[model samples]
Target: MQLISTLATIGFVLPLFLALVGVLLARRDYGVAAAWGGGVMMALLVALAIRGVLRGDPDLPHFPSGHVTLAVAFYGGLLAIYLRGGLNRDRTAVPVILATLAAIALLEGVSRILLTEHTWVDVLGGFAVGSLGLLATGCPWAVRRIRAGSRLWLAATLAVATPIAFMTVGWLDGLIRHWVTL
Candidate 1:
């Protein structure tokens, strides 16, 4: 459960990265890609605002589990993208995949509570925010046919750049740690 929660922690960039990369990998339309990005941004922004108003945990905002938000939006929107775009021609497997995604989301949310990371209300709030953001854009744009043709280069660049970015971050952290210790 701990590992599952940690993996699903969208932490701002993960969902955005996943949305863009998933769209590129799927060869989805620009509109669909935009919708995916918008949906995620809207959910996170709204969740953050709600957390601000509600006043919970000064140390960290946990009113809406970002773990659950991006987990659902990223995967749910991926499913929507596949279903809407007809990426997967086999209609039969869609339901099974949806169920599996839902189950994983459910398990993740439950784990958050079991681990005392969030209350039930927090989890429910996350579910609502994620779903509402996805629905607000509607399926047409979410499934748009306007293709963003620059597939290989952008994704390939990210694939190469991501490791370098991580290495740089790691090096920076080590330097910062040494300076602090001094």
Candidate 2:
């Protein structure tokens, strides 16, 4: 259980490190950095919204695992795009990213189930939602838009958007807790 949680937590936190790496690697072109920043922000917001909705449904009987969703949407999605040359165009990253994502998915999925944090249905739903959210943000058109956006704007957007999204999720989580207690 501890090992599983640690893996899930690592999977959850890996994207932030990847974003920093993207920044360091952005000297040649900021497209990849911009994509990483923008995609993650988008994924976080979408995952939070989905989590809120799932928690609000009294009859739903399951909480879609937010941790699992977040790990997949940000880590899995970003790594997938990076692997496909959407970001770095580095073929060498393919194996590394693929292995990392597989490990994350396995760990997160198994942990959520073992801990009874979510049912299999909930975990699967989270995975699907996360994947779709990533797909939406990682599309060619979205990538082009992110690449075309000004670097200053991208930086500012990430700075502001990331915190707001997180705060919103916190707020929503609280609201759901209150509702349940009521």
Candidate 3:
């Protein structure tokens, strides 16, 4: 349980750092960053709504795991995008990174289930939500425009939005931690 929790924590924290790095070092386009951020935001809202509706109580919602949702949406999405040549030049980098991320996500999902933090269904839901997020930003159709100054604006917006979104989710989860606990 502890091992799983640690892995889960790492998986959760990794994306925030990666997002920062991608934005600052990799010079990821702002629109892409916005897509990722937007996906995360969407997942949170959807999860919260599902929890409220199914659980029949806004104060004690359930069904989807927010942690898993964010992990899959942000980390999984980032990994998927990166593997597609978003940031690396080395040919060998993709496989290694993919394997490592896959392991982390798989482990996190399994642990969450075993620990009763979430059901398998919830985890799957998280994965689906995350995939949607990835698609939202990664799909070619979604990023057809490359206007000048767009990157700067998007990056600046994400620079502010990323941390704020992370903190907001953290605060929200903290508020409902007890109620949502498995």
User: TM-score winner among the candidates?
Assistant: 1
Q: What's the ranking of the predictions by lDDT, best on top?
A: 1, 3, 2
* Predicted model with the maximum lDDT: 1
For 128-175, candidate 1 gives per-residue lDDT tens digits of 888866775455645553343433344464556445544454455456
lDDT for residue 1 in candidate 3, whole number 0-100: 62
Q: Residue 176 in model 2: shift from native, Å? A: 16
- Show where candidate 1 strays beyond 4 Å: 11-28, 56-61, 87-89, 137-139, 145-182
Per-model TM values vs. the true structure: 0.68, 0.58, 0.64
Kindly list the per-residue Cα lDDT of model 3 for residues 1-182, writing each as its tens digit.
64644433423354454545455335545565566566666766677677667786543344666667666765676564454434334568667767877776677778788987777887887677666665665666435343344445435745675565555544544555656443
Give candidate 2 misplaced runs (Cα > 4 Å).
9-25, 59-62, 84-93, 141-182
Positional deviation of 65 in candidate 2, in angstroms?
1.4
lDDT of each: 0.64, 0.56, 0.59
After superposition, candidate 3 runs with Cα above 4 Å error: 6-28, 57-61, 84-89, 141-182
